[model samples]
Target: MMALFRNLFAAALFVGILAAFEPLNYKDCKSTFKINSVKADGCPQENGKCVFKQSTFKINSVRADGCPQENGKCVFKRGTNPTIKISFIPDRDLPKLKASVRSKISGGSTFTTFSLNNDNACEHGIECPLKAGQTYEYTQSVEIVNTYPVVDDVQVNWVLSDEDDSNKKEICIVFLAKITE
Candidate 1:
Protein backbone atom coordinates (compact mmCIF):
# COMPACT_ATOMS: atom_id res chain seq x y z
CA MET A 1 0.00 0.00 0.00
CA MET A 2 2.84 2.42 0.74
CA ALA A 3 4.45 1.91 -2.67
CA LEU A 4 1.11 2.37 -4.42
CA PHE A 5 0.48 5.63 -2.59
CA ARG A 6 3.94 6.95 -3.45
CA ASN A 7 3.44 6.19 -7.15
CA LEU A 8 0.07 7.88 -7.24
CA PHE A 9 1.41 11.01 -5.54
CA ALA A 10 4.30 11.31 -7.97
CA ALA A 11 1.99 10.92 -10.96
CA ALA A 12 -0.33 13.62 -9.69
CA LEU A 13 2.53 16.01 -9.12
CA PHE A 14 3.80 15.50 -12.66
CA VAL A 15 0.35 16.11 -14.13
CA GLY A 16 -0.08 19.35 -12.18
CA ILE A 17 3.24 20.67 -13.41
CA LEU A 18 2.26 19.94 -17.00
CA ALA A 19 -1.04 21.76 -16.61
CA ALA A 20 0.61 24.85 -15.16
CA PHE A 21 2.91 25.20 -18.17
CA GLU A 22 0.23 24.62 -20.79
CA PRO A 23 0.44 27.06 -23.70
CA LEU A 24 -2.19 29.69 -24.44
CA ASN A 25 -4.72 28.56 -27.04
CA TYR A 26 -4.78 31.00 -30.00
CA LYS A 27 -5.83 31.34 -33.63
CA ASP A 28 -3.78 33.21 -36.19
CA CYS A 29 -5.93 35.45 -38.36
CA LYS A 30 -5.04 35.01 -42.02
CA SER A 31 -3.01 38.03 -43.01
CA THR A 32 0.23 39.26 -44.56
CA PHE A 33 2.47 38.12 -41.72
CA LYS A 34 4.27 34.96 -42.79
CA ILE A 35 6.25 32.72 -40.51
CA ASN A 36 7.43 29.16 -40.55
CA SER A 37 6.23 28.43 -37.03
CA VAL A 38 5.36 30.23 -33.80
CA LYS A 39 6.61 28.71 -30.56
CA ALA A 40 5.64 29.35 -26.95
CA ASP A 41 7.48 28.39 -23.80
CA GLY A 42 6.77 24.78 -22.75
CA CYS A 43 4.29 24.47 -25.64
CA PRO A 44 4.64 21.28 -27.61
CA GLN A 45 4.30 20.94 -31.36
CA GLU A 46 3.78 18.01 -33.70
CA ASN A 47 3.89 17.91 -37.50
CA GLY A 48 4.52 21.66 -37.69
CA LYS A 49 1.34 22.41 -35.75
CA CYS A 50 0.75 23.56 -32.21
CA VAL A 51 -0.74 20.78 -30.10
CA PHE A 52 -2.99 23.07 -28.05
CA LYS A 53 -4.78 24.72 -31.00
CA GLN A 54 -4.48 25.42 -34.73
CA SER A 55 -2.37 28.55 -35.05
CA THR A 56 0.06 29.87 -37.65
CA PHE A 57 1.21 32.94 -35.74
CA LYS A 58 2.81 31.60 -32.61
CA ILE A 59 4.07 33.96 -29.91
CA ASN A 60 6.84 33.14 -27.46
CA SER A 61 4.56 33.69 -24.47
CA VAL A 62 2.00 36.05 -22.94
CA ARG A 63 1.98 36.89 -19.24
CA ALA A 64 -0.73 38.82 -17.41
CA ASP A 65 0.58 40.19 -14.15
CA GLY A 66 -1.82 40.60 -11.20
CA CYS A 67 -4.40 38.36 -12.81
CA PRO A 68 -5.02 35.14 -10.94
CA GLN A 69 -6.44 31.97 -12.38
CA GLU A 70 -9.78 30.99 -10.93
CA ASN A 71 -11.65 27.95 -12.22
CA GLY A 72 -9.37 27.85 -15.29
CA LYS A 73 -9.77 31.51 -16.30
CA CYS A 74 -7.69 34.59 -15.62
CA VAL A 75 -9.64 36.87 -13.31
CA PHE A 76 -9.29 40.61 -13.85
CA LYS A 77 -10.64 43.00 -11.27
CA ARG A 78 -12.66 45.98 -12.38
CA GLY A 79 -11.00 49.42 -12.49
CA THR A 80 -7.55 47.92 -12.39
CA ASN A 81 -4.66 47.81 -14.79
CA PRO A 82 -3.00 44.57 -15.80
CA THR A 83 0.38 44.50 -17.42
CA ILE A 84 0.70 42.27 -20.48
CA LYS A 85 4.01 41.02 -21.78
CA ILE A 86 4.30 39.50 -25.23
CA SER A 87 7.28 38.03 -27.05
CA PHE A 88 7.14 37.47 -30.80
CA ILE A 89 9.14 37.62 -34.00
CA PRO A 90 8.07 39.78 -36.89
CA ASP A 91 8.28 38.12 -40.31
CA ARG A 92 8.33 41.37 -42.28
CA ASP A 93 9.67 44.86 -41.98
CA LEU A 94 7.01 47.09 -40.48
CA PRO A 95 7.50 50.86 -40.41
CA LYS A 96 4.53 51.64 -38.23
CA LEU A 97 2.25 49.51 -36.09
CA LYS A 98 -0.91 50.00 -34.10
CA ALA A 99 -2.29 47.85 -31.33
CA SER A 100 -5.91 47.27 -30.38
CA VAL A 101 -7.84 45.03 -28.00
CA ARG A 102 -11.39 43.73 -28.22
CA SER A 103 -13.47 41.44 -26.06
CA LYS A 104 -16.50 39.27 -26.63
CA ILE A 105 -18.64 38.29 -23.69
CA SER A 106 -19.69 34.68 -23.47
CA GLY A 107 -22.87 33.99 -25.51
CA GLY A 108 -22.54 37.39 -27.27
CA SER A 109 -22.47 37.71 -31.03
CA THR A 110 -20.64 41.03 -31.26
CA PHE A 111 -17.29 41.99 -29.76
CA THR A 112 -16.81 45.18 -27.80
CA THR A 113 -13.66 47.19 -28.49
CA PHE A 114 -11.63 48.66 -25.67
CA SER A 115 -9.71 51.89 -25.92
CA LEU A 116 -6.00 52.13 -25.21
CA ASN A 117 -4.26 55.20 -24.02
CA ASN A 118 -1.50 54.84 -26.57
CA ASP A 119 -2.15 52.59 -29.52
CA ASN A 120 1.17 53.27 -31.25
CA ALA A 121 3.56 50.34 -31.08
CA CYS A 122 6.51 52.71 -31.44
CA GLU A 123 5.45 54.54 -28.29
CA HIS A 124 5.56 51.24 -26.47
CA GLY A 125 8.88 49.31 -26.44
CA ILE A 126 9.05 48.50 -30.13
CA GLU A 127 11.33 50.59 -32.36
CA CYS A 128 9.89 51.70 -35.63
CA PRO A 129 10.79 49.82 -38.84
CA LEU A 130 10.85 46.40 -37.27
CA LYS A 131 13.13 43.97 -39.07
CA ALA A 132 12.20 40.54 -40.29
CA GLY A 133 13.48 37.33 -38.72
CA GLN A 134 14.19 39.15 -35.48
CA THR A 135 12.47 38.68 -32.15
CA TYR A 136 10.87 41.53 -30.18
CA GLU A 137 9.20 41.84 -26.82
CA TYR A 138 6.39 44.31 -26.01
CA THR A 139 5.09 45.23 -22.59
CA GLN A 140 2.00 47.30 -21.89
CA SER A 141 -0.40 47.89 -19.03
CA VAL A 142 -4.07 47.83 -20.09
CA GLU A 143 -6.73 49.43 -17.99
CA ILE A 144 -9.78 47.37 -17.06
CA VAL A 145 -12.26 50.17 -16.61
CA ASN A 146 -15.23 50.10 -14.26
CA THR A 147 -17.59 50.48 -17.18
CA TYR A 148 -16.88 46.93 -18.32
CA PRO A 149 -19.54 44.45 -17.28
CA VAL A 150 -18.52 41.88 -14.70
CA VAL A 151 -18.67 38.62 -16.53
CA ASP A 152 -16.99 35.25 -17.01
CA ASP A 153 -15.61 33.41 -20.00
CA VAL A 154 -14.80 36.57 -21.94
CA GLN A 155 -12.88 36.06 -25.17
CA VAL A 156 -10.21 38.75 -25.59
CA ASN A 157 -8.44 39.42 -28.85
CA TRP A 158 -5.24 41.44 -29.15
CA VAL A 159 -4.08 42.59 -32.54
CA LEU A 160 -1.10 44.46 -33.97
CA SER A 161 -1.70 45.90 -37.38
CA ASP A 162 0.26 48.04 -39.77
CA GLU A 163 -0.48 51.73 -39.40
CA ASP A 164 -0.45 52.36 -43.13
CA ASP A 165 -2.74 49.46 -43.89
CA SER A 166 -5.01 48.23 -41.16
CA ASN A 167 -5.68 45.07 -43.15
CA LYS A 168 -2.07 43.98 -42.81
CA LYS A 169 -1.67 42.35 -39.42
CA GLU A 170 1.65 41.80 -37.73
CA ILE A 171 0.27 39.77 -34.87
CA CYS A 172 -3.15 38.48 -33.75
CA ILE A 173 -3.77 36.47 -30.61
CA VAL A 174 -6.82 35.38 -28.63
CA PHE A 175 -7.16 34.22 -25.04
CA LEU A 176 -9.87 33.74 -22.40
CA ALA A 177 -10.23 36.06 -19.41
CA LYS A 178 -12.86 36.85 -16.80
CA ILE A 179 -13.88 40.13 -15.19
CA THR A 180 -14.88 40.30 -11.53
CA GLU A 181 -15.78 42.87 -8.93
Candidate 2:
Protein backbone atom coordinates (compact mmCIF):
# COMPACT_ATOMS: atom_id res chain seq x y z
CA MET A 1 0.00 0.00 0.00
CA MET A 2 2.75 2.44 0.93
CA ALA A 3 4.63 1.57 -2.29
CA LEU A 4 1.50 2.20 -4.38
CA PHE A 5 1.05 5.64 -2.81
CA ARG A 6 4.70 6.46 -3.37
CA ASN A 7 4.47 5.49 -7.06
CA LEU A 8 1.39 7.65 -7.58
CA PHE A 9 3.07 10.62 -5.88
CA ALA A 10 6.15 10.19 -8.05
CA ALA A 11 4.07 10.00 -11.23
CA ALA A 12 2.17 13.15 -10.26
CA LEU A 13 5.40 14.98 -9.60
CA PHE A 14 6.76 13.95 -12.98
CA VAL A 15 3.65 15.13 -14.78
CA GLY A 16 3.79 18.44 -12.93
CA ILE A 17 7.38 19.00 -13.96
CA LEU A 18 6.57 18.24 -17.58
CA ALA A 19 3.62 20.60 -17.57
CA ALA A 20 5.76 23.37 -16.11
CA PHE A 21 8.27 23.01 -18.96
CA GLU A 22 5.62 23.08 -21.71
CA PRO A 23 5.99 25.61 -24.49
CA LEU A 24 4.12 28.91 -24.19
CA ASN A 25 2.62 31.27 -26.76
CA TYR A 26 4.25 34.67 -27.08
CA LYS A 27 3.61 37.40 -29.73
CA ASP A 28 5.33 40.66 -30.60
CA CYS A 29 5.37 42.89 -33.66
CA LYS A 30 7.05 46.10 -34.89
CA SER A 31 6.30 48.18 -37.97
CA THR A 32 8.54 50.58 -39.93
CA PHE A 33 7.00 52.89 -42.55
CA LYS A 34 8.55 54.86 -45.45
CA ILE A 35 7.29 56.97 -48.33
CA ASN A 36 8.69 57.57 -51.83
CA SER A 37 7.73 60.62 -53.80
CA VAL A 38 8.43 62.18 -57.19
CA LYS A 39 7.18 65.17 -59.13
CA ALA A 40 6.58 65.72 -62.85
CA ASP A 41 8.97 68.48 -63.83
CA GLY A 42 10.02 69.01 -60.27
CA CYS A 43 8.41 68.93 -56.86
CA PRO A 44 5.36 71.21 -56.67
CA GLN A 45 6.61 74.48 -55.25
CA GLU A 46 4.58 76.37 -52.71
CA ASN A 47 5.88 79.82 -51.81
CA GLY A 48 9.07 78.95 -53.73
CA LYS A 49 9.43 75.75 -51.66
CA CYS A 50 9.42 72.25 -53.08
CA VAL A 51 6.62 69.86 -52.18
CA PHE A 52 7.46 66.27 -53.08
CA LYS A 53 4.76 63.83 -54.22
CA GLN A 54 4.48 60.43 -52.54
CA SER A 55 3.22 56.84 -52.70
CA THR A 56 3.18 54.82 -49.51
CA PHE A 57 2.59 51.11 -48.72
CA LYS A 58 1.24 48.97 -45.95
CA ILE A 59 2.95 45.87 -44.41
CA ASN A 60 0.98 42.93 -43.03
CA SER A 61 1.03 39.32 -41.75
CA VAL A 62 3.14 39.49 -38.60
CA ARG A 63 4.33 36.24 -36.92
CA ALA A 64 6.00 35.36 -33.66
CA ASP A 65 9.57 34.28 -32.88
CA GLY A 66 10.07 30.66 -31.88
CA CYS A 67 12.55 30.82 -29.07
CA PRO A 68 12.70 28.84 -25.86
CA GLN A 69 12.31 30.84 -22.72
CA GLU A 70 10.39 31.09 -19.46
CA ASN A 71 7.32 33.11 -20.45
CA GLY A 72 7.07 31.74 -23.98
CA LYS A 73 7.29 28.02 -23.23
CA CYS A 74 4.95 28.58 -20.30
CA VAL A 75 2.18 30.55 -21.95
CA PHE A 76 2.35 28.86 -25.36
CA LYS A 77 -1.14 28.18 -26.57
CA ARG A 78 -2.28 25.18 -28.64
CA GLY A 79 -3.75 26.81 -31.77
CA THR A 80 -3.26 29.81 -33.96
CA ASN A 81 -6.22 32.16 -33.55
CA PRO A 82 -5.06 35.74 -33.10
CA THR A 83 -2.48 36.65 -35.74
CA ILE A 84 -0.63 39.96 -35.91
CA LYS A 85 -1.60 42.61 -38.52
CA ILE A 86 0.40 45.48 -40.13
CA SER A 87 -0.93 48.66 -41.75
CA PHE A 88 0.28 51.81 -43.59
CA ILE A 89 -1.15 55.03 -45.12
CA PRO A 90 0.63 57.28 -47.61
CA ASP A 91 1.27 60.81 -46.46
CA ARG A 92 0.77 61.94 -50.09
CA ASP A 93 -0.95 60.87 -53.35
CA LEU A 94 0.44 58.23 -55.70
CA PRO A 95 0.41 54.51 -56.60
CA LYS A 96 1.85 51.95 -54.16
CA LEU A 97 2.79 48.33 -54.63
CA LYS A 98 3.56 45.64 -52.09
CA ALA A 99 6.47 43.74 -53.51
CA SER A 100 7.39 40.97 -51.11
CA VAL A 101 7.39 39.94 -47.48
CA ARG A 102 9.13 37.10 -45.59
CA SER A 103 8.21 35.52 -42.30
CA LYS A 104 10.34 33.03 -40.44
CA ILE A 105 11.09 32.19 -44.01
CA SER A 106 14.33 30.35 -44.67
CA GLY A 107 16.56 29.48 -47.65
CA GLY A 108 13.26 28.23 -49.01
CA SER A 109 12.06 31.69 -48.03
CA THR A 110 9.41 31.49 -50.68
CA PHE A 111 5.86 32.48 -49.63
CA THR A 112 4.37 31.62 -53.01
CA THR A 113 2.55 28.64 -51.50
CA PHE A 114 0.79 30.83 -48.99
CA SER A 115 -2.62 32.36 -49.69
CA LEU A 116 -1.54 35.80 -50.96
CA ASN A 117 -3.89 37.98 -52.98
CA ASN A 118 -4.14 41.47 -54.42
CA ASP A 119 -5.35 44.44 -52.44
CA ASN A 120 -8.05 46.56 -54.13
CA ALA A 121 -5.92 49.72 -54.04
CA CYS A 122 -2.62 49.23 -55.91
CA GLU A 123 -0.55 47.25 -58.40
CA HIS A 124 2.11 45.64 -56.24
CA GLY A 125 1.31 42.11 -55.02
CA ILE A 126 4.03 40.76 -52.70
CA GLU A 127 2.72 41.75 -49.32
CA CYS A 128 -0.61 43.13 -50.49
CA PRO A 129 -3.33 43.63 -47.91
CA LEU A 130 -6.92 42.42 -47.94
CA LYS A 131 -8.17 46.02 -48.02
CA ALA A 132 -7.24 48.87 -50.38
CA GLY A 133 -6.64 51.60 -47.81
CA GLN A 134 -3.50 51.20 -45.68
CA THR A 135 -4.35 48.45 -43.24
CA TYR A 136 -3.43 44.86 -44.25
CA GLU A 137 -3.42 41.54 -42.46
CA TYR A 138 -1.82 38.07 -42.73
CA THR A 139 -2.54 35.23 -40.34
CA GLN A 140 -0.20 32.52 -39.05
CA SER A 141 -2.03 29.22 -39.06
CA VAL A 142 -0.64 27.62 -35.93
CA GLU A 143 -1.36 23.93 -35.86
CA ILE A 144 0.80 20.91 -36.63
CA VAL A 145 3.42 23.42 -37.72
CA ASN A 146 3.88 24.49 -34.15
CA THR A 147 5.53 21.16 -33.51
CA TYR A 148 8.83 22.96 -34.02
CA PRO A 149 8.45 26.66 -33.28
CA VAL A 150 10.43 29.43 -34.95
CA VAL A 151 10.94 33.19 -34.92
CA ASP A 152 9.96 35.17 -38.01
CA ASP A 153 10.34 38.65 -39.54
CA VAL A 154 8.26 40.22 -42.33
CA GLN A 155 9.97 42.57 -44.80
CA VAL A 156 8.27 44.48 -47.61
CA ASN A 157 9.04 46.84 -50.49
CA TRP A 158 6.91 49.28 -52.48
CA VAL A 159 7.48 51.12 -55.73
CA LEU A 160 6.82 54.85 -56.04
CA SER A 161 6.71 56.90 -59.21
CA ASP A 162 8.84 59.98 -58.91
CA GLU A 163 8.11 61.93 -62.06
CA ASP A 164 9.32 59.63 -64.86
CA ASP A 165 11.64 57.87 -62.41
CA SER A 166 10.58 54.80 -60.48
CA ASN A 167 11.89 54.36 -56.94
CA LYS A 168 11.42 51.71 -54.30
CA LYS A 169 10.81 52.07 -50.57
CA GLU A 170 11.45 49.43 -47.92
CA ILE A 171 9.67 48.57 -44.69
CA CYS A 172 9.88 45.90 -42.02
CA ILE A 173 7.18 44.23 -39.97
CA VAL A 174 8.63 42.24 -37.10
CA PHE A 175 6.83 39.69 -34.96
CA LEU A 176 7.31 37.37 -32.01
CA ALA A 177 8.58 34.18 -33.71
CA LYS A 178 7.92 30.77 -32.29
CA ILE A 179 8.22 27.19 -33.64
CA THR A 180 7.46 24.51 -31.16
CA GLU A 181 5.52 21.35 -30.42
Q: Which clashing pairs does model 1 show? A: none
lDDT (CA) per prediction: 0.64, 0.29
Q: Deviation in angstroms for 86 in model 1? A: 1.1
Cα error, residue 125 of model 2, in Å, equals 14
* Backbone clash count for every predicted candidate, in the order shown: 0, 31
How well is each residue in 1-181 modelled by candidate 2, as lDDT tens digits? Answer: 9999999999999876434321121121221233111111111122222111122343322222222233212112334322222234433343344333233333445442222344322433224322334443222222323433443322121122222223444333322223333
TM-score of 1: 0.70
